[model samples]
Structures are given as structure tokens and as C-alpha cells.
Target chain A: MADAEAKERRILVAVDEGEESMYALSWCLKNLICESSKDTLILLYVKPPRVVYTALDGTGYMFSSDIITTMEKYSNDVAGCVIEKAKTLCRDLQNVKVETKVEHGDPRDVICEMTGKLGADMLVMGSHGYGLIKRAFLGSVSNHCAQNASCPVLIVKRPKSTAGSN
Target chain B: MADAEAKERRILVAVDEGEESMYALSWCLKNLICESSKDTLILLYVKPPRVVYTALDGTGYMFSSDIITTMEKYSNDVAGCVIEKAKTLCRDLQNVKVETKVEHGDPRDVICEMTGKLGADMLVMGSHGYGLIKRAFLGSVSNHCAQNASCPVLIVKRPKSTAGSN
Candidate 1:
């Protein structure tokens, strides 16, 4: 069903194709309500920096052409997966609007920036995403987003043992 | 290491024996530094409900009791383990204050209660702590706390795949 109220309330779900994130997305679908209207679900995924730099005689070297191409391809593939999953979930919800967004750069910075532009009220996200290994080496997107986001964030916790359960 | 400048700052960590909880505790130890002579780490653990019930089978003869145990033995064990871990970690931090407390109730409620009663400025915790099976049955503590907390909360995101990687 289409209506004016359905277009308003916003619930942003940061997806990285992880169990916790999916659980959070599911939770949002089940709990969020706008008094008399349905809420909007936005699936957001931020692609990590693909430009790799090497130390060429102590000076930073530009990313190789092949690496850059591969990075773009990989980012597109991951983003596509997020959109697909969100679409499947949206099919089940009644009148709620579900949209997808993808961006590049720091996950926290991008989310904070987006929130400023889009007055979203709640951030639903899983604590661990597909980039867990990379995050452990550098940092975690969930941590940064929770710390920096202006709005309240729902961090769905998934236990290691339950990784494959969901 | 122990002087007048190390007595004012206090760090409160909600310990639950979940590795993710420890991650938040570690982050607090790394950050939330005190400029003066006071540094205290308070490890708080809230024990959730644990009771046993016995009932009679249908038909004519089997009778059983519906009495719940006074306390949950497993919960106590988890709290004890978390406290021990915190104590061991606190040994190396210089000019820091460390303590442990375990209470019974909902973790989010207990945390808020403790913070209010203690007048804590900041809170650090892992994003999720419920084990796989329990999480499926109940829910994650961090998500609940984020929605209901009155003060600032730092929810540390655990990596999805922290195995084999450093």
C-alpha cells in the first residue's frame, strides 16, 4: 500500500552482510513504528578505502592500476549484495518504504555526515560485519558509528558460536 | 606511579565474562585517562534471573515441585570469571583504581541503576554479551542499554572473525 505517512519515519540500517547486522535489520522491521504510520528502512553500506599505498623508498606510492580496478569491482559486488538482501526483506514488510545507499570513505565519518544531511532518528546495525578481519586490523565500523553518531544506535550483538546460526 | 595526581578519574566497566565486554574494558583502560592523581576502574556485572521450576506430569501420579532455586549458579560463575579477568588486567595499569560489583536483574536496568546511584560520568561496554543460544532466546545487553541509557555509552564492536588474526 502507498501512503504519505509511509514516506516519513526513517530507520537507517548499516549493512555489511553480517549476522548481527541482519538481526538488527530484522529487529527494526519488527519494532519501529511512527504512531500511526509505517517507517522507512534505509540500507546503508560504506565501502572501505580501496586505494592502497606502498612505501617506495620511504615515500608513499600511488595505488597500482590493477589493484584500483579490483577494488572498484569488489566494492560494487559487496554493495550489490547489500541492496539485494534489503530488497528481499522489504518485500515482506507491508507499507514501509525501504531504500538502499552506498558510499566510500571512513564508515563513521560517512554515517555521521549522512545523519546530518538526513535527519534519521535511529541507526540499526549489527556489531560485526563481513569486514571483521579488516576491521580487527584497523578498527571497527560499528564502534566508530556508535561513538560518533548523533542519534541513538542499535548495535545487535552476535556471539561467535552463533555466527553461522543466523 | 602512585601519587596525588592519580586519585580523581574513575573508569566503570560493565563486565560480563563475554570477550566483547572485555574489549570495552580494555578500551576504557586505554582511554578515559585521568589527568590528576585518581584513576579507578569499577567492574560491574549484573546477574540475570536464574531459577528452576518443577511441575507434575499429566494424568494420575507424577508430582513435582514448581519452586525456583534461590540463585542461579551459572550466573554467579560467569560474574566471578569476569571479575577475575578484570583484576588480572588491572594489575598493569599505573595509578588506576579497580573494583568489581555484581548485582541481579536486567543488565540494562542494573547498569542504569548503578550509574545513577554511583553518579558515573561515562559507561563502557561491549556491543553484545549473550551467548549464541541465549541470544536467540533473549537478546543482546548492549542494544538494550543503548536505547535506555541516560549517560554517554561506549559500545565496543567485536570483530566478526577474530580467530587466527592478531
Candidate 2:
């Protein structure tokens, strides 16, 4: 039992375009990943659901399919870019397997669901460090995941000293 | 810079008499601590503040100093026992420095303050898995520390399957 417990672990890390998540990935690499273990690092990026706008909602113009396609392409491009950046950060990892996953949904729900569906031993994500009012308004993904995730959740908050410098 | 980043880290773990905290400590030991790094694990146990009683409106009876002294001694003994149990869990750890500290106060404030004072790189604790109503009434210590701690917070939740079996 001890050997199985200390063997391979699947660590799911939620990443996004924000520097905070990138910092979390870096932090996990530095602090959590052990050189002797065969750890699988799953980098998950959740894209916001596509908005369906209708002409009846006071907008005088009808949206074209071309425009919707362009917006979706932009979202995909952003996801690809973020995943590429995250992959670059993992270039130096040894004895670890890195996988990338991109999904579309509310980040809070998607991240939590993915943690369970993926059978992750642990979930690592970054905290936005939003103040009370802002967090109430915008809703914190990390907080929601921390409460709902089945596995242990690691919420990495970037220090204030390096928040702006990075 | 890379060497410095991969060097020693101070990890502060808040523990108590509950089984949940022992699970978190064991989880941290299995997943977070690396054999090659010089990680210092600080085990902190916070004893709830003693309640003060007054005869002005409560039970119309005055409490004796002996009772208060006995209560204080019991609290100290509980703290000592908890720390001793935590240390036992770390007995197999190698290349890791384990330190124990006991403080008296509300756990939320003490754990957060100690993380800052101790300059911890990460703060780990267990989630009580309280329901919405219970959490609203009891005020979760892990949730508060996750919000207020200066460092990253890892909230470990025991799997429901093994929660009762242990």
C-alpha cells in the first residue's frame, strides 16, 4: 500500500491566460513534483462558454455566422496560445509526463468536474486574490473548486511583491 | 536562481485532534515532501481560547479558580497529545526537519498569522467537509486560512470512502 501510494500520481493543474496560473504551474514544478516519482501533470485550460446573442435583445443588427465563427476561432487561438506557453514552462521537467487538455464551459464547474473525471490525486490552481467585493461580483474559480473538488486542492496565491514585477 | 528556487522550503501544516488533520499531514508527506530537498515541516496545533465565566448573569454561580486551572491543564494536555501524534506521523521522513508549535487562540487567526511570521512557502490544512448551514455557523478554519494566509494554502479533504473506516 505504501509503495502504491508513493508511486505514480496524476496531478491536475488548471491553467489559463493569466500569469497567476502560470505561476501556480511553476510553483507545482518546484515544490510538489518529485524527481523519483512518475508523476503525470495534466494541464487543463477551460474556455468560457460561447455567448448566443439574438437581435431581439435591443441590438439593431443581426449577427452573422461568419462573425460567430471568427469569435470562436479567436477563443480557440487563445486556448492554443495559453497551452503552448504552459507547455514551454514544462520543458525542463524530468521523469514526469505532461498532458494538455482544453475544454469549454464555466471554469469553476469544468475544473471541478475534470478533477473527479480525471481521477486526479490532487488539483493545483492559482488564486486570483480578488478582494471581497470583486470576488463577490466576479466569482472566484479557485474558491469554488476548493470547496467542490473531490481531491485535495492547492490554491497558489502569487505574492504581492512579485505580482506586478512578473 | 533555479537552484535557490529548488532549495529549502518552509511548509506550515495546521493540525488538531481531528482525524481530518492527520489525514492531511499524511497526504502532505506522501505527495509534497521530496527526498532530495531540505524541507522544513512545521506542525502547528492551536488550542481554542479558554472561555471566561461570570456570575453576573450566568447560572448565578461563581466558578472556582481550581476549575479554570484544571480546564487550562486539559487544554495543554490535548495540545501536547496532538503534537505528539503529528510527530509520530513524520517519523519516517528523511532529510526533512520537523518542528512543533502550540498556540492558544482562534485557529483561523493563529494559523494565518503563523504562516506569515514563520515565512512559510505553503500552508496546508484539512477541510472539515461541513455542510452549508454548519459552515455558516462554525466558520471554516481552512476556508479562512485559504483566504487570509500569506502563502499558498493546500486544503486536503479525506476521501469519503475511507473517512469513516479510519
Candidate with maximal lDDT: 2
- In order, the B-chain TM-scores come to 0.74, 0.86
Query: Each model's RMSD to truth, in Å?
Result: 18.8, 4.2
The docking category that best describes candidate 2 is: acceptable
| Candidate 2 residue spans exceeding 4 A from truth | A1-6, A51-67, A129-138, B1-6, B51-64, B129-138
Query: Which 10 consecutive positions of candidate 2 chain B have the poorest summed lDDT?
Result: B129-138
Best by TM-score, which number?
2
What does candidate 1's lDDT look like per residue over A37-136, in tens digits?
5566788887775532232123556767896787689778978987788677657666566778898876767876776466766566766544655565
Local lDDT at B14 for model 2: 90
Q: What's the true lDDT of residue A48 in model 1?
A: 70
Write one digit per residue (lDDT tens) for candidate 2, span B19-84: 888999999988777655678999999877554223222676666889778778887898899899
Instruction: Give every prediction's interface RMSD.
Output: 19.1, 4.1
- Find the 10 residues in a row with the least total lDDT in model 2 chain A: A129-138
The whole-model C-alpha lDDT of candidate 2 against the native structure comes to 0.80
